[model samples]
Target: MTTLQILWFILIAVLWTAYLALEGFGLGAGMLMPFLTKSDRERGAVVKAIGPHWDGNEVWLLTAGGATFAAFPEWYATMFSGMYLALFLLLVALIVRICAIEWRKKINSDQWRARWDWAQSISAWVVPILLGVAFANLVQGMQIAVVKPSDPMTAVPVDQIDLAHDVHNLVGGFWSLITPFTLLGGIVVAALFLSHGALFLNLKLAGDLGDRAAKLAAPLSLASTGLTAVWALWAQFAYGSGQPLAWVPLAIAAVLLIVSTAATVTGKIRPAFWASFAGIAGAVAFIFTNMAPDVMRSAIDPAYSLTLWDASSSYGTLKLMTIVAVILVPIVLAYTVWSYYVFRAKISVDDVHPAGLLKDKIRLGENFLATN
Candidate 1:
């Protein structure tokens, strides 16, 4: 890979890892809804914990996609085309999940509230699943018809790569999305979010709600750490390397998991949150370490597999976008941190307005606007 390409890849990896960590907290938070909150009032607390920042967290995912498209067009095309169906469903789920939060207050009716609850629940649940699936696919590597130099954009002349006929391809595909590895990732993520929700709730809510959330946090966190360790090892092996290089991420993952669990068990909420974040962050680090160079590796022919250099956009395009990103990324990070600080607090039953003050701000004159 060219220096520019490597730099772009590194930057994209960092952005994606941050996105996973940042948005992942909210995902973990949301997934805790069914288990953590009992009533509309407590549920409101749950919503309030993430309500202030969830939208912004979502932008990272968009940014990551944009970066991918800019830095690695070939990889983008191959992934989107091969996984179009999965991506479509994920998009729909995300839409519904975001909409549910806004529509919840349109009416005060119990049924309306209940509908919102379902939306919240689904959003929380489906997002992590989609992420896990996507990661699984990343590890599995899809079948993409290699484009020859001249035929790169020749329309329908290229054949699509198929996973069904190849044992290695099929194994990789199943391994990517369906294995114990990714599912463990799913579970660990769920628990991490739940713990994050608890911390968010403890900071934002009070009375029975906060106490109950706190009670659930430690156990959820511990379980998640355990699952993460197991899956990290499996993922390392699955990615290849019979030698000890595979153990690097596994050891890092284990340490993070252990530290996260210990911190949570001791009731150090923020530390626990950070530690859990560390665990997930370590996993992302491992992903890069294991899958570097190739955005997508081929099970069929190693020669045909796409590498960072092969899959990337032109150097000019990458340099242009990289310059732009260097300016924008810090600003994005600053605002994200500022917003989180501004909104950080324990949400209460009383915090739930039929129309919350922050609600209008989120909508900006849209249908979900709060009266304020």
Candidate 2:
């Protein structure tokens, strides 16, 4: 592989890591809203804790998709087409989750808020689970059939022919995406995000809410640690035997999860959260590292696997993309950091009162405008 191909692969991996780390807490917070608080004001506080950053965090998802499409069009085409149903459901869940967040506070009716709360909760849970399943499948390899086109006039050599035009078909129905290993992956990620969110709530809330969050975070983090350790070992045994280097990140992830659990038990919320973030980043890195060189592995035949070198766009396209990314990525990171700094204050039920709804709406509007 060329240096640029390897660089783009690492960049894509970084984007996915950033998405899971930042958005994990937001989705976890949303999933916890209904169960974490007894009163509407308390629930509002839970929602508000992540409200300022949820939309911004979602940009990572968009950027990751865009990056894949630009850098590895074949990988993008096969993965998206193969996993169309799953991706469609994920899109719907994301939309419902976002809409619920924005519209839940527009009125004061209990029934209305309750409906939206369910919407938000269900979608939040579904999104992460699906993402986890997708990632797990990527690691496990998919049933991909690559059919090359025949062109007599061009007389292109078989070895030199690009498979971009090959018919990359996924075998089986949507049900095939669900399996024992993939389900385990989904559970692990869901548990990790739950723990991450609980720690965030602990950090951003005060009084009874914070105490509850801390208590909840302890168990969730423990669960996450256990599940992650299991998943890592499973992945290592299942796919990492050939790539011994993958074990490094897997071991690091296991250690980070342990640290996260310990810190949570000790009531060190910030340290616990960062550890959880690092654990997730390490876990994702392990998967990509294991799958490296091959962007998409074929379950049926190793010969049909899509490699970074084979699947990537033209050199000129990648060079242009690299220039654009270098210029824009840092600016986005800086603004995101600045926004977090500005909003780095604890919240309480009092902060989400009916009287403050108007201010919240105005602030939300400004955030929307600024992000757009």
Which candidate gets the maximum TM-score versus the true structure?
2
Candidate 1, residues 297-359, lDDT tens digits: the string is 665556456678767788899889878888988999899899988886656787776643443
Best by lDDT: 2
TM-score for each model? 0.83, 0.91
- Model 2 worst lDDT window (10 residues): 149-158
lDDT of 2 by residue, 199-277 (tens): 9999999899988989899989888888888887888788663877898898898889899999999988899899999
CA lDDT, every prediction?
A: 0.68, 0.85
Superposed on all Cα atoms, the candidates' RMSDs to the truth, in angstroms, are 6.2, 5.6
Stretches > 4 Å off in candidate 2: 148-165, 355-372
